[model samples]
Target: MREDTFCWGIVGTGRIATIFAEDIQQEPGMEVTAVVSRSRDRGHAFAQSQRLRATVTDSINALTSSGNIDAIYIATPHSDHLPATMAALQSEYPVLCEKPMGLNVAQVTALADLAQKRGVFLMEAMWSRFLPAMNAFMTLLRQGAIGEPRALFADFGIDVPLAPDSRLFNPALGGGALLDVGVYTIALAHKALGRPTNVYGRARWTETGVDGHSAYTLAYGSGAVAQLFGALELNTPQQAVLCGTQGRLTLQAPFFRPECVSLTRNNGETNHQYHPVTGNGYGHEAREVADMVRRGRKEHPTMPLAESVAIAATMDELRTQWALQYPDEP
Candidate 1:
């Protein structure tokens, strides 16, 4: 809890949890002091790999209630986010939850309400927003590097084993291309253009009836349009471009992290490359959380709590248009 050294209690032992652990570990003033998994075996495995001298518990309550942890990071599955986040916030622990805060907007909205009423620090761990490349790119856009942003073209796609058990194809676990990889594309669009005045979506479903390959277009109140795409059935460029009246910006693969970034103004183009400054570029968000907690702030100004709820709402609208609903959802 000290300002100079923040301790993180992580919940969930998934792949993203590993990345989060790595990123938070390398932060100058942060350390992951504990981890909670569904099973003791899984918890110890993560503890051993991360090489932490912290407590490993199978119980979310144990980790959230511990005085040893200064903050909580929830990296559980899509369906599990609400419980983990609710538990942490209810314990009065500051929390940084993974993106898509929950399976739907209603879930996240309630959490936000609780956070507000409880006066606990809470934020969606939208790591991409804190990336060096992303920040710089946004700075350019603000400076009219891309004047009057008119359109955004973004996509993410990959070929994965189509097994029904896989999270991408399973409807019961809140799995689908839109909620998974597609979220990244949509998040970027939100940054460039706020909420759209209208939303539309269409998708090709998998055998399990979840979204397989899909595309959507968003019309913003500013008269700007964002064309987005996502797919688990095939491979895509995984790139993005924002076009405007004065210029355009192009982001390389993994547009969220953007190993490469470029700016074009009326015909002249300049490029910049950023290597992993830290573990998977997630350390940026970790550092931001530490600083915010140090300042006793409840929400990150960069990725405000309100905006987090809005993104979830946008996703809900998209899913509705496609008539796609997870088994556990209405």
Candidate 2:
């Protein structure tokens, strides 16, 4: 490894971690040098598959204090995000944790506070926000291509089998459509509308006690609203739309990682655009974190810690409405 290369230490060996490792490998002057997993055998296998010439351990402490890693990425299950991220921050490591950041608002807020006190760089891996297409969409909105924004509609639903042992339906693993894919819808809404004046939601519970299907509406002070839906028990279009006084923008299916968007104005004028990504779109966030760390910044402006806390609060409110609580959550 080059002395100037930015080395990363990953805290999980799951699918997302594998994707991250793959994407980071495509970046110049960056490398995955260490990984932590509960199972040493799995960690070793992951390293070999990813072709990482790095350490494979089961301890977060070892990864954080190796004196070689420049930053850490937490890709563990939802329930483990808090503990893993906490360990990284306490060890004075910059962290880019996966979405939902924590199980609830309290946990997310605590992490933000700790990172602030340490003056270290900490950001939620809301990777979608950094996508090329999403950025282009935001730029158009800002330039009034959609006029005054008035409403939004988005949903992400996939039909996964009813396997109680899988993380999707397991309460102990922080399973549920809301925590898993629903955050994308809410995040897009939050990006366009900021914090909602009020949040209204309803959920259908699974036999395992977690939410199976759910819907929510966020109300803003300017009379704007966002309608969002998510489900693990059903399949949906997985599209999104933003309506304005004079026009509307629609993102193609699987909107969270969209490549195309269409804008139609009231005057019957229309425009279509495409924005492509490199390496599954995970490298964008990795590069952003590396730039911020090298610049000595403590937080990302686009995916700030405060906004992550706010989004977690919104999710907490929805869980409260459904009377759903994870077993391990305090």
Candidate 3:
């Protein structure tokens, strides 16, 4: 490990954690030097699977307090996000908590306050924001290349296997299509068209009481509207469209990490493609976290602490509309 490198203690052994470990090792200036799992065997197994030459611990304290660790990446279940993040914050370590940072807005706000008091870097790992194509897409929207963006449409739905114990359907684990994949649609739409003034939504609930499918609309004060939806039982096209007065932009399927964008101008059939990223794209966010910490910044400008809470707030309202609540949420 280079002396100037930032070392991350990964606090989860799930799929997300695995992807993070695989990607981070490929990047320079940062490394995942430790892992925290629920059980010793899980921790060891994860470390072995990742082929990491680092310490593996089952306790958050052991990993968070390590002198060699520079930050903590909370990739645990949604229900574990708060306690894991709080522990890392209390230990004076900056954190990159995965999206849906908490169960609800209140939980997210508490974390923001804690991180502020601790004066450490805290960011919701909404990785899409940092993708090169996303930045370019934002620039195009900002530059008025598409004229006035009046409406947006986005969706993220995967046909997940219905296993009650799986995080995608487990209420106790803070699972559902909304938190698991819907946040991406919300985050992207909200970024392109500021916060909405009103949110209307409906959903189909699983027998386990979690949201199985949901559709929602966000109305902005500027007359911009966003129609976004997510589902756990069906697979939609997973694309996103931004329509403006002069032209339109469409991020193809898998919009979250899209590699191609389509721009149509002046109602003509003329189409243009913009491709602007390489690799799995998780490195962009990790790179941002490293840069922010290096500059002693408490939060990233693109994905601030406030935006994280606000997005969760919208999800909270949508859940209310559906009358769905996780058993573990207070």
Candidate 4:
């Protein structure tokens, strides 16, 4: 809350939380002031490794009660985002939660409404939308570089060893391929095609009663369709393609962390490569949140709350189609 810097409180000590802590340490105007984890030893170790002056605690109430943090970053699992975010909002601290934002659309809407009522800034940590390359790509699309994006194909999948109780395969933990990795593809599709009129999905479920692989086809009223695939049992190409009447755009490997894009037009093929980002590409989102809070904004202009709701709705519909229900859903 200081004029020159923002003090951040991290709400989890998981893998992603560690990455975000490191990234925050690298930024000039930000500091990790506290870290909350169920394991006191892990929280203390994380704080020590980052050389951060932090109040490490296992309870959410204890972490938020310090009344010293300017903002909180929710790095817990998708199922835990809602409760953790609510805790931060109740404490009058703005929140930046990692995507897909929630286990379902209702959770996202409730959080957005709560943040609004509390007059606190809330942003979903959809880091891809904050990347420089994605920003440029959106600009090009708006400028008719691709002549009205007509179709999009995106895939994100990985081969993970099957452990029934692991979060990735556990139904009680909101585990599935769609929530795990397909959310990225769905977000991109929604970005290019808007909300779909209809969604069709097919999945291969694991023995542990969770989806191991899945495919989705979304039909838009504009006569465009997006084909998306995600899996935990296979290693996919994990690329994104946007095709229009005039040209096509291809994002290289790791579409979410894309650093290069190729555009093919009637004139010729052009390749654009973005500068390598510092601090594992998470600094972009951190800086974005800081800028928004500094300007007294409630949400980001690029990735608004409505977009988050629509993306969650799409996932909800996809889940309905595949008959895949997370324990958290109802």
**What digit string (tens of lDDT, one per residue) describes model 1 on residues 1-330?**
455688988888889999988877777778888989879899999999998777998877877656788889998878888888998888999999987798889988988998998999999988988888887778888998778999999999988979998766888878888888888888888888987788888898899889988888989988899899989998999999999999888887878777667877777766665545466888888889888888999999888888878889989998888778776675
RMSD of 3: 1.2
Candidate 3, 1-330: lDDT as tens digits: 889998888999989999898898888878889989879899999999888877988888988656688878999999989999999999889999999999999899999999999999999999988987677778888889899999999999989889998988988999888898888989987799978889988888898888888888999998999999999999999999999998888887788988777787886765656666555678889888988888999999999999998999999999888878878665
Clash totals for all candidate models: 0, 0, 0, 0
* C-alpha lDDT of candidate 4 relative to the true structure: 0.86
How many angstroms is residue 90 displaced in model 2 relative to the true structure, after the best TM-score fit? 0.3
Winner on lDDT between 2 and 3 is: 2
The runs of at least 3 residues in candidate 3 whose Cα sits more than 4 Å from the true structure, single-residue gaps closed, are 269-271
Candidate 2 C-alpha error for residue 45, in Å: 0.6
Model 4 residue 305 lDDT score: 88
Pick out the ten consecutive residues of candidate 3 with the lowest summed lDDT: 270-279
Of the two candidates 1 and 4, the one with more favorable lDDT, higher being better, is 4
1-330, model 2: which lDDT tens digit per residue?
Answer: 999899999989888999999999989999999999999999999999999998988989977667789999999998999999999999999999999899999999999999999999999999988888888889888999988999999999999998999988999999999999899999999998889999989888899988898999999999999999999999999999999998998887779888888899989798989988788888988999999999999999989999999999999999988888899665
Clashing pairs in 3: none
- Clashing pairs for predicted structure model 4, backbone only: none
Q: What TM value does model 3 have?
A: 0.97
Give each model a TM-score.
0.95, 0.98, 0.97, 0.96
